[model samples]
Target chain A: MRYLRLYLHFLRFSFSRAMEFRLDFFFKIIMDCMFYVVNLGFYKILFLTTPMLAGWSEDQTMVFVSSYLLVDALHMTVFASNMWMIPFSINRGDLDSYLTRPVSTLFFVSLRDFAANSFINLLMAIGIFAYTLMNLKAPYTTGQLLFYVGCILNGWLLHYVLQMIFIIPVFWTQSSRGFSDFFFSMGVAIERPDLVYRGVLRWLLTLVLPFALIVSFPARLFFGPETPHLFLHLVFVTLAAWGFMLWFWKKGLRAYSSASS
Target chain B: MSWPARVVSTELRKILAYRSDFWVNFLGQTIIQLFIARALWQSIFESNGQTEIGGFTLSQMTLYYLLAPLTIKILMGENIGFFSREIYDGGLNRYLVWPLPPIGYKLLTYLTYSAFYTAQLALLYTFARFFLDDRPYELSEFLRLIAGLGYILVAAIGYFCMMCLCELVAFWADNTWSLGVMLRFVAGFLGGTFLPLSFYPETLREIIQYLPFAAFISGPVNLILGRSTPMEALQSFVVMLVWLPILGLAVRALWKKGNLQYTGVGM
Candidate 1:
């Protein structure tokens, strides 16, 4: 119960702090939107010359793109902001305050960075997704919809865990900048449909790194509603990745010596 | 006795002092570009089988992508708008009092860093060339490639100077990073750094081709690919000449105007 209160306080603090930077908040929305718009334009051009891309129809591709945007926005808002703050907090020993709190240190760090501005992008993604679905003449069944929502949540957990695995190394690496860039770049894998990759790289994305699961699996639920097994596999992969990252985070904390010394 | 060479040598040694970090950053950037290009090329190939994209063969497109990181390394500075940092931190005050004219100082500093970056790009390009799956050009074509590289460098400098002109807004806007971010985003789209303008609709491509932003990447890429002749290169060069003087004048006027409004404290 006490931990709950502490988490809420951190959440409130994050909300208030984000509100203070109104221009930054709007800029964040615009930046995310512009990036998606460019991707959309690329798809438009790609489809202009060809009616289909890699067996995915124009509307199906649009859904995939929207899902990619939604996942990216969620990752940026929930996990990335917190992960980015970790290195700075550790370096400045500001992390000590969070460490000593009654709540879990992980909870404190992650919950303290709920970027409300990214909600704008999230909303835009949903609008686009809905619009594209209508255009495609696809109807969402209740079961399929439930599975999609579950997969999205699971994907978010998977994303947060993988981000933690990448970020936890900052304790030992001392500078997280390279790792941060790498993490973000790795996240770029989700921006494209999993179908684009082939052979060894495809296997790695599907099994090992499992980044494709972040978007492709949930997106598959919508696009290929008949393939429920893929959604279950995605959930299983998410769980495995979450387990690995949690273990790594604990190991990293043991290695962390406060930068103050 | 060349001014650029004089400036570059002094800058190279200073950068070399932190050589390990610099090399790591360069290597990391290169790897990222490689993978991204790999992903993009795979998609393009899958979409169109052996067909020309924007007049580029599959091999040519791969080469274009391979060359992108090197071009970015050569032409790009530490920051797109370092002038903003100068203005915000009162570093401009020091430049103001310098014996060299303000434009001369900006030009020299730009050259200094650019030369260091050029060496870095050359090293990386050589490394990429060995490993890259592309055919080498004939000797004559290779020489023309070098000339193309020179044109690209000059054009890049022209664009950077224009950005410096925009950074003069910092004299009014103060310390927000958004101005720089916004400008870089604009350039990323309009400059064909994100996606080549050739991929855009013909009407849109035509508009972008004449814009200052197109000179940043597409013009040079076309020049190297032999899409443009020597006369065409000369015309592009003349366009840059027109832009450089105009932007230089704008920067000077803004500097003088901004200086009048300068509170200097906290800015």
Candidate 2:
């Protein structure tokens, strides 16, 4: 309950900071939208050449792109700005200030830098998602939307938990920027659909890293409803990653030799 | 005797003193580029067959990605925006007091950073060669590679000078870091750092073909990939030369205007 209040305060402050500069807000929105438009343009070009890539139809692929964008925006809204700051805090011992706070140090540091600019990105992602869904003319029941939202919420948690786990090494290494980028690179797998994988890669996606589960399984809820097993796996994986991140954070906190010394 | 040799030696000594952050940043940057390149390559493979893309085979594409970041480091990824920092903090005041002219001091600082960036690029290239798959080039190809590299070098200098002009705006704006970031993004996206401009529509590509950003990275990468012949390469070089002097003049003009209106804030 206390943590929820802390998170709410962080979100409120972060949103205000984003809106602090009206021009910055509008420009960022336009810029991000232009980037998404380019991706949409890429898809249009590809579809003109062929109906499908790697065995998925245009509508299916659009859903894949939409899901990736949605998950990405969700991650940005919740975590990106904070994750990027971890390095600076570790290097400057600013994490120490957060540590001394009344709230959870992890929660404080992770949620402190709410990116105001990303609100536009978030809205844009939702708009694109809606357009894709409408184009597909897919049936939308309240139960389905609820489950879709639930899976995406779980997906967002999975992303955050993995990020925290990857960044935990910063406490021990004193610098983890390289590791962070590498994690992001590996995390790129989440952006593609799981249908694209085969054999060992499929098993790897399911069991080992589970990058495919991030976008694919949640998207499956909408596009491939027959895949109930994947949705269950998504929940399972999210819980497992959440547990791993919590364990790692605890161990990392013990190893944290405050930067001042 | 030459200006570059003189600046590079002093810069090398200074860079060595702060080598840890330098190497870490270089390695970190390389890793990010590699990942992005890998992701894009995977996408391309998924979309198209195992054929050449914009005249590059899969292995060659990876090689281009590997070299692109190193090329960026060599050309324009240094302290290209140091002028903005100096303008913001009134560090330009020191340059004004020096026996060397302020503009000359700024240019030397630019050269110094470029020197450090070159060393860092070399380190990254060494690391890349270990892990990345690239085809061997013939003697003639190596010559063309040199010519292409020259194009990127001049283009980087021209682009950096233009950025220095943007940084000079710090003399007027309350903060220009966002502008700097926006400018870099323009350069990166338009210049084909994120993805090649070749991927754009013919009309858009034709228009960007003339823009300063295309000349920065894409033009050179295309040249090195043997996508353009010597005539086209020479034409690109001519375009860069034309842009360089214009940007240099603009930098001077902005600096003069900024200094006149300088509030000497937060010095």
Candidate 3:
């Protein structure tokens, strides 16, 4: 409850900051709107050439695309700006301030800065997701809809975990952009259906990086055949990712040397 | 050496000084893009049960992806935000007193960096040859490749000028980072960095073909792929040439007006 209140404070501060930069606030929305358009258009164009891609129909693929966009927007809103600061903080030893905070330092550092600009974009993404859901040819039950939302949240969490894993390497490498670039490159996997990948690459995205699960799995759960096993897979992967994050965070902190020290 | 030549060499030396940074930053990104493009295109082709889509076989499409990064490196201008930072922080005052033209200095530096990036991409291509299937090049294709390189050079200059105009928004706005990002996204989509313009609807593709963005990337790629005839390639070159001077003029005009607004108080 205390953490919730603290997060509320962060949210308030974020909005105040956003209001001070009204032009930037609008520009970010326009930029993301363009991004969303381009993303949808890419899939639309692909469908024009072929009726189905990777066994998924055009409308079904729209749901997957919308899922990733919402996940991306959520990530940008809640985590991106905060994560971007980590390398700079570590380099400058400003992370000491975070470490000294009373709350869980990892949670505090990672979630403190809500990107209020991106929050508006997040709403736009949600609108798109709703549109896609409405237009989906296959009828879904209320229970399935709720389950899909839960899975999308899981996908967002998985994205955060994967990002943190990439970021922890900065503690040693001291190269801020290197791992971040690599992470973004890997991020492209989530944009397409996981079924497109084959062999070791498929396994890598599924188990190791888990980009496949980030967006595709949630859409799969909703549209594809009922697979009770998938629920177990999602749970196992989320737990495994969470466990790995805790271990890596602890290890990174131990190696951290404060500037004053 | 001439002043411009000297500037280029100095910038080239600076890039060489931090060559490892390039490998870490660029090479990883290029490889990742290649991986995604190859996987996505292969899957699409497999699902369609067709050997060709938009005149590109799977191997040809893979080759296009491999070459697109190189073309982008040579043609797509960097968003250095140098002039913007200078204007915002009063660093422009230092350049104003310098002997050389600031724009010339910037252009030379950008060209030098592009040259280094192209050389690095060439090295990667040599390495990639072992992994990728070889595609035979006809004499006409080689000639078109040379022509494509010329077009890429002009497109790079035009893109640099356009970026300069975008960055000049800092003169009025507090920050131009958002504008820079918008410019990049627009360019990436319209320039065919994400996918071939041919993949777009025919009407849209036809319109984009004449847009400066196509001149930047897709036009060059089409030339190298032998997708466009000699006349068509020449027409794209003409389009690039037309846009470059207009963009150059806009940059010069913006810089002149922006200079009047410069307070140089930050220094």
Candidate 4:
């Protein structure tokens, strides 16, 4: 409950900050909206040449694309700003304040800023997700719909964990944006179906980096036939990622040499 | 040496200090993009059971993707927020006292970065060619490549001027970073950084091909690939030539007006 109050305070502070720059706020929304349009257009054009991509039809792939867009929008709204600031904080020893806070440092650092600018984009993403779901040929049952929503949340958490895993390396590297750039580069893997990848690349995306599990598996759960093993795999990977993030966070903190010290 | 030449040399020296950043930005990002684009096009071709799509063989498409990242790096210009940061943080005051114009200095700095980036990409492409080993080229192709380089240089200047105009908005708006982000997103789509312009419908592709955005990336790339006819390539150069001076004038006018509004307090 105390953490909840702290998060509410964070939300209030973020809203006030966003409101201070009205033009920037609207510009950011427009920027993300453009991103969504381009993403949809890319797939639309690709589908014109082929009926199926990686065992999924155009409509099914549309759902997959919409799922990832929602996942990305959710991350932007909730986690991106905080993640972007982590390197700056570490470099300047501003993280010392985070460490000294009463709340959980990991929780505080990761969730401190809710990007109000991207909130409208988040709503737009949700609208697209719902629209795609309605258009899906295989009508989802209420229970399956609920499960798909849960998996989308799981995917968002997986994204956060994956980002922090990359970010924690700043403690040792001290090169701000290096790992993040690499992270962005690797993130393209999630844009396509994992089925397209063969052998080692498949294993790497599914088991190691696990970007495939983020959106693809959730979209698979809703659109494709039942894959009980895949659900278990997603659960296992998320838990393992969470565990690794906590361990890595502690390891990074222990190695942190504060600026003042 | 002229002032702009010295400025370029100084910027070249400054860039050498951040060698790791250059490698990470170029090699790390480009290799990943290459891998993803290869996998994507491979999947598309396999799914359709055809080796060609939209006039590009699979190898040709792979080559296109390979070149796209390098082309974007050169044409996009660096220091996206250079003018805005200077104006907002009162760094413009330092430039105002100097005899050299700030826009010229900025343009020289970007050109220096572009030169460094091209050299690095040349080395990277050499490494790539070692493995690929099948990019057949004749004398005309080499001539087209040279022509494409000239067009790219013009397009880079136009792009730089446009970005400077975008940054000059900081004189009025408190934060222009969002504008930069917006510009990048729009340009990435329209400029064919994400996909080939040929992927679009004929009417849309025709419209985009004449736009400054296509001149920035798609036009020059397609010219080098021998995808465009001589007339089409000439048309692209004409579009760039027209936009460059207009954008250059806008930057000059904006900078003059913005200088009047500047009050250097934070310094």
Candidate 5:
């Protein structure tokens, strides 16, 4: 209840702040819509050339794209600004304020600024996801969809954890960007369907690095059998990833020598 | 060194100092994009048993993907923030006081980066000549490759003008970064970076062919691949030439208005 109250405060403050830059608010909507349009158009044109991509039909691909868009919109709304500011917070010693607060530093840092600008975009993404899932040929129970939604939320959490893993290096490297560039390069896997990747790349994206687990795993399982294998795998990976994130965050904080404040 | 030479030298040094960021952002992005494209296209071709789609064989498509990255690198360049950072931080005041033309200096900095990318384009074309094992580019194609570079230089300058117009909005708006983002998104689609304009409907393709975006990505790639001739590349250049003068005037007018509005206290 305390954390929820703190989050509500954050949402209130962020909305008030967003109202200051009215042009930026509108521009954010346009920018995100352009991105969504391009993503949908790219697949639309590709599907015209070939009926199937990675054994998934146009509608199935739409589901995958919409799911990724939802995940992205959720991230943008909640975590993206926080993660983007981490390097600066570390570099400028501003994180000391976060550390001194009574709240959990991780919670405060990750959730302080609710992106009210992206809330509308998030709604648009959810609409796309819903529209794509409608008139579906694939047979799945509401229980299955609830399960898939649970996995997708886990996928979003895993995305956060993975990004934090890349960003925690700012405590030492102080390289301005840390290792975030490499993280983004690998993030391409999150946009693409998992089956197109073959052999070692498949193993790498799915198992060791596990970027595909962010969206593809959830989408694939939605269409596939209601097997516990993938669900258990996702739950295990996400829990382990969160555990690693907490451990790494502690280690990074220990290593941090605060810069000029 | 002369003023222009000194500016170029400093930009080159900056590139060397942050070469890691350059590799990760530019080359890393290009490699991953090509990897995904290759995997996706290969699957489509294999499943459908179609060796060619939209006049591009698998090999030609690979070459397109390769060349397209170079075109993008030249256009986007190494500076992610570029001029907007200077304006936002009020560092533009320093350049304004300099006895040289500010726009000229900035343009020179932009082309220096493009020149480096242009050299990379040549090297890649040469590498493709020998190692595109299934169908190597012949010597005649190499001549066309030189002609194609001329068109690409035009595209780089053309895009620089467009971006300047975007960034110049910073004078009035607190954050003009979104304009740049919007420009890049539009360029990615309409410029044929994500999907070739050839794949669009006939009317759309024909209209976009006259637009600088298609000439930016597809025109140069097609010319080097022998899918287009120097004549066609020249025609694209002519189209770009029409947009150039108009963009130049807008940029000039904005800089003048911006200078008048400048309080020089970083807003």
Candidate 6:
């Protein structure tokens, strides 16, 4: 309850701040919309020459794209700005401020900036998602829809975990951005349907590094024939990932030789 | 070394100083992106059941994706916000005090990043040759590769001018980072960095053929891949050349206007 109240404050302040830079707010929306267009266009153009991409018809592929976009939108709205600041704060030794706060440092740092600008984009993403679902040939039940939304939320959490895992390494490497570029390079998988991957690569993306699971697992649950086992596997991996990130984050704090010192 | 040359060289060395950055920026990104592209194109060809899509074999398409990002890095360079930062934070005051053309110094640093990435491309191409099944290049295609690189280098200046004009917007706008990002996304999409021009709708492809973005990326990659003869490459180069002066003049005009507006108050 307390955390939720704090988040409300964060959202309120973020929205107020966003109004100050109205032009930037709008430009960011346009920028993200273009990104959506390109992602959809990529699959669209490929489907032009082919009947199926990894067994998903063009409409199904569009749904997958929309799913990823929603994940992206939610991640951007809730986490991206906050997660992006971790390495910088670590580098500047500004972690001291957060650590001294009365609230849980991790919760405070992670949810402090709500990215109200991107919340608009999130709504836009939902519109795009609705548009795609209208074309979805296969009808889904209310249970399935609710389950899909739950999986997407999990996907967003996984993205946050991955980002923390990538940025926390700044404690030792002390590089400005840590492993973000590599993480982003790997994130290309999220834009692509995991069905396109095969064999070792598939397992690697699903279980090991789990970049593909960001949208792929949730997407699979929504689109593929009942893969309860696979969904359970996603749950397990996501839990394990969270455990690792929390442990790694603690270790990073221990290693965090303050920059000024 | 001359003053500006030493400045650029020293700045380049500083950027390469962070060992982690050096690895991620040069080595890891290229390798990972290539892996994804390889997987994607493989699935594409298998699903399509076509040996050729838009006149490209899987191997040729792989080569195109590889060259696309590299060519774009050379053309777009790094977005260090040299001018944009100065404009926003009143750092331009220092540049005005210094006996230098801030634009010239900024270009030197910008192209240094491009040059560094170009070296990365060359190094990766050499490494790739060992892993690739066939000889990656023919002796006959050698001159065309050289010609393509030559045109890319010249085109880099034109791209620099365009970006300069963009960063100049900071003088007027409250922030321009969004503009910078918008430009990159637009450039990537239009320049065929995201996908081949062949994948584009015919009308869109024809329109983009005359655009500088295609000439900057598609024109160079195709020429290096031996898809285009010297004459054809020259035709593309001519298209880019026409934009060069227009962009350069725009940069000059914008900078003059921006300087007039610049209060250097750190506002």
lDDT of 5 at B32: 65
* Poorest stretch of ten by lDDT in candidate 1 chain B: B19-28
lDDT of each residue in A118-224, candidate 4, tens digit only: 99999999999889877888767899888888998999999999989888877876766537877887788889888777777788889989989998888888876
Once fitted onto the true fold, the runs of candidate 3 whose alpha carbons sit more than 4 angstroms away are A259-261, B1-21, B125-140
Clashing pairs in 2: A18-A116
Ordered from best to worst TM-score, the candidate numbers read: 6, 4, 5, 3, 1, 2
lDDT of 5 at B95: 72
Residue A79 of model 6 has an lDDT of 88
lDDT of each: 0.68, 0.68, 0.81, 0.82, 0.82, 0.82
In model 5, the runs with Cα more than 4 Å from the true position are B78-80
Ordering by DockQ? 6, 4, 5, 3, 1, 2
Cα lDDT tens digits for candidate 1, B1-267: 675566657666765654444555555456655565566566767677746766766555655665654565455554555677777677766754655566665666666666566655555555654565356646765665677677667766775666676677677663445555565556666666656666778898777666676666666666666667788766666766677777768877887898897765536
DockQ of every candidate: 0.29, 0.19, 0.54, 0.59, 0.58, 0.67
Record all residue pairs in model 1 with backbone atoms less than 3 Å apart, i.e. clashing.
Answer: none
Top-TM-score structure, candidate number: 6
Tell me the deviation in Å of residue B36 in model 6: 0.8
For model 5, the interface Cα RMSD in angstroms equals 1.9
Better model by TM-score: candidate 2 vs candidate 6: 6
List model 4 lDDT by residue over B1-267, tens digit each: 988878887887776654565566555578867877888888889888997888988877876887767777776667578888877788888875899877887888887777676665556654664466475646886687667766777777888887887899888887787777777777778888788887877888877866788878888888877888998888878887888888989988998898778887531
* Candidate 2 chain A: worst-modelled 10 consecutive residues by lDDT: A176-185
Alpha carbon lDDT at A89, candidate 4: 86
Q: Local error of candidate 5 at A236, Å?
A: 2.9
* Better model by DockQ: candidate 2 vs candidate 4: 4
Candidate 1, after superposition: displacement of residue B197 in Å?
2.4
Our tally of clashes for model 4 stands at: 0
Model 2, A71-120: lDDT tens per residue? 77877777887898887777667778888878778777777777777776
What candidate 1 gets wrong by more than 4 Å, as runs, is A1-26, A225-229, B1-28, B43-48, B80-117, B123-136, B162-175, B260-262, B265-267
The fraction of reference A/B contacts recovered in model 2 reads 0.04
Error of 6 at B86 (Å): 1.6
Model 4, residue A80: distance off in Å is 0.9
